[model samples]
Target: MDDLASFLRNRRARVVPAEVGIATDTRRRVEGLRREEVAHLSGVSVDYYVRLEQGRATQPSEQVLDALARVLGLDATEREHLDRLARRPRRRTKPPAGKVRPELQRMLDLVAGAPAMIMNHRTDVLAGNNLAALLFGRPLPELNTARHLFLEEDERGLYADWDTCTLDVVGHLRLSAGKYPDDPRLASLIGELAMGSDRFRRLWARADVCARTHGPKRYRHPLVGRLDLHQETFAVPGESGLELVVLSAAPGTPAEDGLRLLAGFAAG
Candidate 1:
């Protein structure tokens, strides 16, 4: 219920009245469309929408959800996310923390071009090749990607573009929370970040969700200088929510040379 309310509030903040062909006034104090505006646009009573956003009412029906989604300009992903939130919360069982399969580790070993890691839904780095360990730094699990960005002091210098990285990391965490709302570890992680970082709290409040399977990322490695890696994510077959993330540069590129240098340095 709380997640549903938070999602609605976040969506509301991103929409503007005038942009959606509604009247606007400077007298308004809120950042985006008000409750009444959304209510009106969706053809729902203000009291009903208020109760819905406050999480005081029961789960909204499909008709109501469709109306809200349309009024809020939610994309396919966001619309699906909205549906999940609006549904009644289900009790979910947590699986044991998993190990990367032997074959997966072997595959990682064979990938000599770049850093690679196996990550779980909660951003725990289950296993990593030598290059990933050297670049991300340190022991298993402690190097949780989201935690590194929000809680680690040196992380500010590790990524060339800290803001973009944090957005992606937070979005990753937010998406996981929606999928595994009952996971205590994830809840604890979110609580820790909320306590530790005002910036994190603000971003988390936006309630965005993104999964970057393939993308470019900038890093400032201590040994290799600037690196621009094209990252790829693959889901482990027969493994739920396990992703193999590989970061590589094109052949003969400076970034590729940097990875080769770092791999050698990491070996020693």
Candidate 2:
């Protein structure tokens, strides 16, 4: 099955009996909502929903998808994800190689106070400012973050909370992979990581998916020690493959001071 179908199945399995007002009966054969139950809640016919889950149906109407989202109790991100899946044209086309446009590079350079980097859907660091290099410890010229996390030995040392960070990376990648299953680049990256890193293989097998657009991130900088920062990712308009990520620290904090110091060091 494709990623979307598998994801829906997994999510269905996760909503427990108590959460949806279902009884905890040991006699129940299935782990989650029955196909009929989901169809009922989604205002769709059981056969139609089953066809959707089986990857036989495509192009579900927005109203039906919204109903499904409501039935699934999806958050804002999850709802958008479902819509994307429903609206996705039937094609196995690969994503074009993601590149940072000159204007985006200029924008990154212009942001002097905050460290910024442009990353593709595959989490490849296409470009970054000097401050970003300083903060992330001078990322290798052609390194992809997903590859570095799974294959590079130094990744654990760089990310203080290695386990949590690694899981998050893997989960996020899995989500992206699901969204763009036909992308050869993403497939190759996942295949290589699965073969090389047992940890990545295990995580991928779990089928966990996540979308972290904005959040607090803690990093152990080689030069600045532990630094707590907020991270936000902005999609570059008119650019399908590029995303700009900016990191900032709270004002009047040690992290802010460290960031300033690091920026100065980068300049020097």
Candidate 3:
């Protein structure tokens, strides 16, 4: 129907068969749990749930939404987003989301030993510093972080914890979608990813929403081998659509040494 269908489908795929004590079969073909399975767990009619997912059903009551949320095990943010989407009468288009500021580039470059970049809520890598370029490789035609994460083959090798990165990307995009449901580019990006990668499509359906300002990350650097770094994300004052992300390591740590090595080897 709209994002609701996608959300339900995605959330359904994330549930484990045994999670609800359902027996498993290797022949099960659907991504997470089947539509009938979710309906069964939520104690709703399979036909009604199918209509809801197909965008044919009327607005659901609070109890129904709560039941579905509980069945899917949605977190607070995800549950709230679902409520908003369900209440919305129709979809309206908005302009493309915000862009990176010129100052972002200058700020990104000032950092010495860290990999730093600016990205929009849609995970578009608008600009990055030399160290970031060295660490993550250079530009792409699309310059979208999620695209690079899912579409690029080498990305799987670059991140030591690829699966964590995948979930994080999906979660961030889900959060952004919830906040700006009308943004055209965001919708387009979501559709593109859903069409491009099965893994991406499966994750997108799960309705996970997260925005982590700071966290630990692991990367595989050819020069320094495995590097563990902390990522800190800073707001740019005026834009909800853009933020600054910097990756760093504690001083004297091996990851710090890797950052130093990249800086020294890449300076112009």
Candidate 4:
């Protein structure tokens, strides 16, 4: 199925009918709301909704999209993704990677106490501070976070909750795929991961989408034992796809002490 159709089917299959006030029965064979049920609840014709699922109806009006989003229980990020899938041209060439601005690199360097890096939509680590280099075991430019998490066996041991962390990574990549539908680099990366890792393929097939803006992450550091940090992400001003991510620990915590110790290692 096409992306839009696939996304709709996945979302439709996930919404439990009873949760949405529809009475459930044991006789029902479908996982969630049927196509007709969605159409009726969303106030659209079954034919139109079926056409949407069949990829024949690509452009739905704002009212229709909002109704559908409501019915699907899409969060803000997923709602935006649905809109993008409905509106943007299906194919576009992503430009070649650009160098990180000197000022942005400087900003990373100035954040000496924590690990900070810049990445694009495809999770290509564009630049990172020295501390970040030490934290990730390589400079950001040398890493694609998704590739590292999914392909590298040793990388799994670094995250305290590997499954949860990797799930977010896959979801983030799905969101990116919605934005840049035909980005060859993204397609290649996804294809490679799917071929190389069964876990990645399973997660990708779920059609989940998410944005990891700010969240707590726990790391199992070989040197420090355990480090729990909060990550903050900011969009780079005037830059289309670049994001700055910094990881910091709360004051007076063991994680903070560990980071300070790591900073010392970075310095020497």
Q: Which candidate ranks first by lDDT, i.e. highest?
A: 4
Q: Candidate 3: lDDT of 138? A: 71
Compare candidates 1 and 2 on lDDT and give the better one: 1
| Residues 9-51, model 3: lDDT tens digits | 7788888888878887888777778888889888899999999
TM-score of each prediction: 0.91, 0.84, 0.72, 0.95
Model 2 C-alpha lDDT per residue in residues 1-268, reported as the tens digit of each score: 1355765776677666576676767788887788788888778899998998898988989899888777677777667667666666764435545666788789889998788898877888889888888876766347687787677744446666677767888877876765786777788888898889889878777656666588777778778877888889888787765678898999998889889989889778
Worst 10 residues of 1 by lDDT: 88-97
Regions of candidate 3 where Cα sits further than 4 Å from its true position: 5-54, 57-72, 90-98, 140-142, 154-156, 181-184
RMSD of 4: 1.8
Better of 3 and 4 by lDDT: 4
Q: Which one wins by TM-score: 2 or 4? A: 4
What's the lDDT for residue 175 in model 2? 62
lDDT of 1 by residue, 42-114 (tens): 9999999999888897778889999999999988777877777766365453543578788988898788868
Better of 3 and 4 by TM-score: 4
User: Which ranges of candidate 4 are over 4 A from the true structure?
Assistant: 90-96, 154-156
Q: Evaluate model 1: give its TM-score.
A: 0.91
lDDT measured at residue 151 in model 2 versus the true structure, 0 to 100: 78
Misplaced by over 4 Å in model 2 are 90-97, 153-156, 206-208
Shift of residue 96 alpha carbon in model 2, Å: 5.3
